[model samples]
Target: MLIGEVARRSGVSARMLRHYDTLGLVRPTGRTVGGYREYSPEDIRRIFHVEGLRSLGLSLSQIGRALDEAGFTPSTLVGDLIRKTEERLNREQELLERLRTVDAAEPSGWQDVLRIVELLHGLGSQSAARRLQAVLAPAEGVSVPAEMLAEAVLTESDPNVAGALRWALARAGGDGVASVASGMASEDVDVRRRVVLALAELPGDEATVVLTDALGDPDTTTRRHAALALGARGVTQAVPELVGTVLTGPNDVEAAELLGTLAQDAKWADRIMSALVYGLTAHAADSAVRMRLTQALAEMPGTTALDTLRQLSRDDDRAVALIASALVEKLEKRLDDELGQP
Candidate 1:
C-alpha cells in the first residue's frame, strides 16, 4: 500500500505517518516508480502497534525502546505507567476536593475565590507556622467557611495549630458541626479523638448530640473527652463515663470536678452520688483507685456524699482514711459555715 492508501485504511494521518517514518518508528518497506513511500503489510502492522502503545501513555522514546529493543519488557514500563497514573489521579482528586471546598465557600467574586485558595494552600503547607497563620489570617477580613476549618481541625496534628483550628471552628459556631461530626465515624482512634475535641469546642445541640453518641466509642480517650464535653453542657448522660474516668484515670481530677458540678443539679445529684459510691465500693481492693474515688466524692453535694465521705474516713487503707478524713473535715466546716455556725 502506498502512503495515501495506508493513511486511508489505517486512519493514521499522512503527516504523522511521515513523522513516524522520519523517526524510524514505521518506515515504508518499499517505494513505487514515482518514488513515493510504500508500506508493506508488516509496516502497517507496526504503525498500529505504535498507536496501541501510545494509548497506554508511553512517550515516543519509550515506545521506540519498546518496539525495537529486544530486551525491553512491558512489565517494568507498565509498572511505571501505573505509578504515574496513580499520582496523576491523586492530584486530580486533590484538585477536585479543593474545588468543592471553594465552591462550598460560595465566594462572592474572583477575589474571594483567590483568598480562599490561598488559605487552603497555606493550611496544607509543610510549615506549621504557615498552617497556623492560614487559620488565623481569615480574621483580618476573609470569612473562611466553617467546613474548611472543620476539615483542618480533623487532620491537624500540631498541638498549637490544632487548638487554633478548634477555636476558629467554635467561633464559626454550629455551622461546622456536621463536618466535625462526620469524623466521629472514622475507624482511627486519633481521628475520633480529634473529632470529639473539635465538637467539644463547637456550641449547639448538633455538637452535643454527636458527643452524646460518642459516649459509646470503643476508644477510652475518645469516650472520656466526649463525656467531659457533654458533662460541661449539662447533659447528665456523661455521669457513667465521668465516674469511670474517676475510677481509672487520665484526667481523673477534671472528671471529678465536672462530676461535682453535675451533682449540683437536684435531679442528677443522687444518681451521680450513687455511681461514685459504687465506684468506691467496686474499686476497694485498688488503693490508688479508691483514693482517687475518695477525692472525687469530695466534689459531690448533699448529705449522701457527706455520709459516704464519713464512712470512707475509717477505711482499711491508711492513705484513703487520711484523705477521706481530711475531706470530711472540710465538708463539715463548709456545711457549718453555710449554716452560720461559729
Candidate 2:
C-alpha cells in the first residue's frame, strides 16, 4: 500500500505519517518509480503498533521505546499510566469541588468570583497565618462562601486558625451547618472533632440539634466536647455526659464547672442534685473521685447542695473528708455573704 492508502486505512494523517517516517517510527518498506513512498504489509503492521501504544496515553518517545527497545515492557508503562490517571482524576475532583463552592456563593460578577477564589485559595494555603487570614479576611466586600469555610474548618489542624475559621462560620449564620454536620460522621476522628468544635461556635438551632445528636458518639472525647457545648446552650440533654465527665479524668474540672452552672437553674436543680448524689455512690470507694465530687459541690448554689457538702465533710477518706470540710467552710461563708447581699 502507498502512503496515501496507509493514511486512509489507519486514520493517520499523511503529514503525521511522513513525520513518523522522519522519526523512523514507521518508514515504508519500498518506493515506486516516481520515488513516492510505498508501505509494505509489515510496515503497515508497525504503524498499527505505534497507534495502539499512543491510544494508552503514551508519548511519541514512549511509543518509540515500546516498539524499538528490546527490553521495554508494557507493565511499567501501564502502571505509570494508571498512577497518572488517578492523579488527574484527583485534581479534577478538587477543581470541581472548588467550582461548586464558588457557585454556591452566588457571586454578583467576575470580581466576586475572583474574590471568592482568592479567599478559598488562602483558606487552603500551606501557611497557617494565611489560612487564618482567609477566614478573617475583610468580608466588607465579597463574603467567603460558607461551604468553603465549613470545609476549611473541618480539615484545619492549627488551634488558632481553627478558632478563627469557627468564628467565621458562625458569623455566616447556619450556612455551613450542613457541611459541618456531614463532617460529624467522617471516619476520621480528627475530622469529627474539628467539625464538632466548629459546630459549637456556630449560632443556630442546627448546631444545637447536631450537638445533641452527638451525645451518643462512640468516641469519648467527641461526646464530651459535644456535651460541654450543649450545656452552654442550656440543653438539659447534656446533663448525663457532663456528669460522666466528672467521673472520667479528662475534662472533669470543666465538666464539673458546667454541671454547677446547670445546677444554678431551678428547673435542672433537682435533676442535677440527684445525679451528683448518685455519682457519689458510683464512686463512693474512690477517694480521688470523692475529692473531685466535693470540689464540684462548691459550684452548686442553694440549700440542697449545701446539705450534700456537709454530709461529704464526714466522708471516710481522710483526704476526701479534709477537702469536703474545707469546701463546707467556704460554702458557709459564701452563703452568709449571699444573704447579706441586697
Candidate 3:
C-alpha cells in the first residue's frame, strides 16, 4: 500500500503519515521498482498500532519505543493502549463529576468553563474568569458538538482563555496533551504560563523547551508557577534554572516553597542552601522576602538545612531568628537520640 492508502485507512492525514514515517514510527516494509514506498501487511498492522497509541496520548517517540519494546505483539499493545486511555477517561469523568457541583448558572459558566480551559491549557486564575463563559457552554449531557468545542477550544483570542486551555491540556495528561501544550507555549504570557503548568502535568521531552522558556517570563506569578512545575518534574536537567529562580526570578512565597521541596534532592541541596543564605542576607533589607524565605527554609528537612537555619537565628531579623531557633532545638533532640544510646 501507498501513503495515501495508509492515510485513508487510518484516518490520519497524508502529511502526518509521512511525518510519522520520518519519525520511524510507521515505516514502509519495502519499496516498488518505480521507487514508490511499498507498505506490507505487517506495516498496516503497525500503522493501526501507531494510530491507537497516538489516540491514547503516546508521543511518536513513545509509541515507537513501545512498539519496539513490546516486540510488536498486537494484542498486548492494544491492551496497554486501552489501559492508558482508560486512565485518562477516569480523570475526565472525575472532572465531569466536579463540574456538576460547581454551579454553572452562578456566573454564566465562567468558573466551570475556566476549569475546563485550565485542564485544556494547564493553569489559570479568577482574573481570567470572564473569558470562561465562551469556552464552556451550559450543556447537561456529554454530547457537545465537536465543532462547537473545537471552535471554543481553538478560535478564542482571550489571553485568559488561552491560559485556561493550556491548563486543560496539562490535565489531559498524555502525549496528545504534551503536543497541545508544546504549541501553547508560544502564546502570550498568560498562555505560556498555563502551558508551563500543563507541561508539568505531562513532563516529557516536549516539556523541556516550555520549562526553559518559562524561566524568563516577566510575570513573577507565572515564573513562580513555572518554578513550582519544574520542581515537581524534579528534572536534574532543570537544576540551573531552578537555582536561578530561587536566587533572582521573583520574591514569591509559592516559588520559595517549591524551591524548598526541590531541595530534598541531595544534588540540589547545596544550591538551595545557597539561595537560602542569599535570601537571609537580604532579610535585613526586605521584610517580606525575609519572611517568605524564612518560612521556606524552615520546611526543608534534614541536618544541613536545619543547621543553617540555627545559624541564621543569630541574625538581628526576628522572623529568621524565631524559625531557626525552633528548628535547631528540634535538630538537637534528634542528634541526642541518634548519638546517646548505642
Candidate 4:
C-alpha cells in the first residue's frame, strides 16, 4: 500500500507515516514506480504497533527504542509509562481541585484568583508559621471560602495552625459546618478528631449536629472531643461518652468538668448523675476503677452525687472510703453553705 493509501486506510496521517519512515520505525518495504513510499504488510503491522504503543502513552522516541532495541522490554517501559501517566493524572487532579476551590471562592478578578491561590498554597504550607498566617490573614483582597477554611482546619496537624484555622472557619462562618461535617465519616482517626474539634468551635445547630453525629466515631479522641463539645451544647446524648472519658481518658479532668456542667441541666441532671452512679457501681468490684469513678463522681451535681458519695463512704476499700468520705464532707459543706446563702 502506498503512503497515502496507508494513511487513508489505517487512519495514520500521510505526514506521520513519512515521519515514521524517516525514523525507520516503519520504513516502507517497497517504492512505487513514481518512487512513492509503499508499505508492505509487515510495515503496516509495525505502524499499528507504534500506534498501539502511542495509545499506551509511549513517546515516539520511546516507541522507537521499544521497537528497535533488542533489550527493550514492554513490561519495564509500560510500567514506566503507567507510572508517568499516574503522576500526570495526580498533578491534573490536584490542579482540578485547586481550580474548584478557587471557583468556590467566587473570585471577582485575576487579582482575587491569585490571592486565593496563594492563600490555598499557604494553607498547605510546610512552615507552620506560614499556615498560621494563611488562616489569620487569609487574604486582604480576597475572601477565603468557608469550605476552604474547613478543609484546612480538618487536615491541619499543627496545634497553632489548627486553632487559627478553626477560628478562621468560625469567623468566615457560612455553611462551613457542612464542610467539616463530611470529615466525620473519614476513616482517618486524626481527621475525625480534627473535624470534631473544628465543629466544636463553630456555632449553630449544624455544628452541634456534626458533633452529635461524631459521638459514635470509633476513634476515642474523636469521640472525646465530640462528647465534650456536645455536652457543652447541652446535648444530653453525650453524657455516657463524657462519663466514660472521665473514668479513663487522659482528658478525664476536662471530661469530668464538662460532665459537671451537663449535670447542672435540670432535664439531664438525674440521668447524668445516674450514669455516674452506675459507672461507680460497675467499678465497685475494682478499687482503682472505683477510685477513678469516685473522683468522677465528685464532678456530679445535686443530691444524687451527694447521696452516691454517702453510699461510697461506707465502702470496703479503705482508700476509696477515705476519698469518698472527704468528698462527701466537702460537698455536704458546700450544700450547707448554698442553703444557708439565704
Candidate 5:
C-alpha cells in the first residue's frame, strides 16, 4: 500500500505518517519508481501498534521506546500512565468543582465572575489570613456562595479560618445546609466533625435534621459536637449524650449547663433528672464522674432535684459528700427564694 492508501485504511493521516517516518517511528518498508513512500503489510501493522500505544497516553518518545526497545515492558509504563491519568482526572475534577461553585454563585458579569474567582482562590490559599479574609470579607458586592463556603469549611484546618467559615455558612442561612450535610457521609472523622460544626451554625429544620442524624456518628468527637449543637437548639435527643458527657468529659461543664437549660422544660425535667441519677448510679466507683453529675443535678428545678441533692449530701465519698452538701445548701436557698419564703 502507498501512503495515501495506508492513510485511508489506518485512519492515520498521510501528514502524520510522514512525520512518523521522519522520527523513524514507522518508516514505509519500500518505495515506488516515482520515489513515493510505500508500506508493506508488516509496516502497516507497526503503524497500528504505534497508534495503539499513543491511545494509552504514551508520548512519542515513550512510544518509540515501547516499540523499539528490547527491554521495554508495559508494566512499569502502564503503571506510570495510570498514575498520570489519575492525577489528570483529579485536576479535572477540581476544576469542574470550581466551575460549578462559580456557576452556583450566578455572577452577573465578568467583574462579578472575577471577584468570585478571586474569593475562591483566597479561600483555598495556604495562608490562613487569606482564608480568614475570604470568609470574613470578600470583594465588595460579591456574595460568596454558600456552597463555596460549605466546601471550604469541610477542608479548613486552621482554627480561626474554620470558625469564620462556619459563621459565614450560618449567616448564609439554610442555603448551605445540603452542601454541608453531604459531607456527613464522609468516612473521614475530621470532615464529618467539621460538617456537624457547620450544620450547627446553620439554622432551620434542614440543619437540625442533619444534626439529629449526627447524634449516632461513630466518631466520638463528631457525636459530641453534634450533641452540643442539638442541645443548644433544644433538641431533647441530645440528652443521652449530654448525660454521657457529664459522666465522662472534656466539656462536661458546657454539657451540664446545656442540660440544665433543657431541664427548664417541664416535660423533659424528670427524664433529665432520671438520666443524671442513672449516670450517678452507673459510675458509682468513678468519684470524679459522680462529682460532675452531682453538680449537674443541681441545675435541675423542682423538689425532685432538691431531694436528689439532699440524698447525695450524705454519700460515702467525703469529697462527694462535701460537694453535694454545698450544692444542697445553694439549692435550698434558691428554692426558698423562688417560693418567697423568709
Candidate 6:
C-alpha cells in the first residue's frame, strides 16, 4: 500500500510513517522498478506495535532498543518499563504527601471557574485556549452541575482547562469575572494563597506576576506555597527569593528539603553548602531536616563537602552515617567505572 492508504488504514500519519522508517522502526520490504516504496503486511503489523509503544511514551530510540532486545513485541519489555514508571510515580506520590499538609487542594469554587473562564476571554495563549474548549465542550446540551463541571475542568489537561474556561468566558462576554480574579490577586493571606495556588496551575503573564507577588506574602504558609508552586511552574523569578528563604527563612525544614530536592546546578552548591553549614552549626529543630541537609551535603563530589559530611559521621543521627556510607560506595563505583576496574 502507498503511504496514504496505509495512513487511512492504520490511522498513523504519513509523516509519522516516514519518521518510523528513518528510526528503523518500519521499513519498506521492496521498491518498484520506478523507485516507489512497497510495504509488506508484516511492515504494517510492526507499525501498529510502534504506534502502541509511542502511545506508552517510549522514545524512538528506546522503542528501537526494546524491539531489538525483546522479540519485536513490547510484552517482553513492558515489565521493565512498568517498574521504571512505578518508581517515578512513587517519588511523585511522596512529594504530594509532603505538600498536602502545607497546602490543601480545595474544590474549584464558582469564582475560581469564573476567573479562569474570564481570563480566557482575552486569552492570547493558544495552549490555554484549546484547553478551555475541551472543558466546556460537553456543555453544548448536557447540563453538568457547576461544581462537577469545575472539577472536570480542573482535572483536565492544564492547557485545555485554560482554553475551555477562556472560551466559555468569551462566549459569555463578561468583565465582572476579570475584576474578581484581579481583586483576589491584591488580597492578603488566604485569598492570595489560594490565588497563587490556582495561578500555579494556570499559564499567563498575569499569573506569573501574581506568583511573583505571592512569594513576598507576609504569611509564612502563603510564601512557602508560592515558592513551591513557582518552582513547579519553572518560573525562574522565584529562584533568588526561594534560595534566600531556604538559607535564612523561618520555615527551616520545608525550605531545606525543597532546596535539596530542587537545586541541580553545581554553581548553587556553595551557597547550599553554606546554608547547610549554618543549619548544622545551629542544629536543626527538626531532625528530619538536619538529616536531609546532611545527605544533600554528602551528595557533592568535592573534597571539601565530603570532609564536612565525614566530620558529622559521628553525630547521634544514624542517618548521617548511612549517607556517608552511600557516598563512599558512590565514590568507589565512580573510580571503578572510570578506571575499568572490577
Question: If both were scored by TM-score, which would come out higher, candidate 1 or candidate 3?
Answer: 1
What stretches of model 1 exceed 4 Å from their correct place?
A: 1-11, 32-41, 264-270, 330-342
Count backbone overlaps in model 5: 0
Candidate 6 lDDT over residue span 210-260, tens digit each = 677777677767776678667665555555555555545555455544555
Q: What C-alpha lDDT does candidate 6 achieve relative to the native structure?
A: 0.58
Question: Model 2 over residues 51-144: C-alpha lDDT tens digits?
Answer: 9888889999899988888998889889999999999999999999989987898988988888888877787789998888777774447776
lDDT of 5 by residue, 282-337 (tens): 88888898889988886776556877788889888898899888988887887899
Question: If both were scored by TM-score, which would come out higher, candidate 2 or candidate 6?
Answer: 2
The Cα error of candidate 3 at residue 325, in Å, is: 1.4
**Which residue pairs clash within candidate 1?**
none
lDDT of 5 at 117: 86
Superior by TM-score: candidate 2 or candidate 4: 4
Give per-residue CA lDDT, model 3, range 253-292, as digits (tens).
5555566677777777887778677766755576655655
lDDT of 1 by residue, 1-342 (tens): 999999999898999999998998899999989999999999999999999999999998899999999999899889999999999999999999899888987888888888888888899999999999988876344677888898888899999999999998888753699988899889888889999999898888888999999999999999999999998898889999999999899899999999989888888888888888888778778999989998888787755578888898999999999999998888888889989999
How accurate locally, in lDDT, is each candidate?
0.89, 0.85, 0.61, 0.84, 0.89, 0.58
What are the models' TM-scores?
0.85, 0.79, 0.48, 0.89, 0.93, 0.41
Better of 1 and 4 by TM-score: 4
**lDDT value, candidate 2, whole model:** 0.85
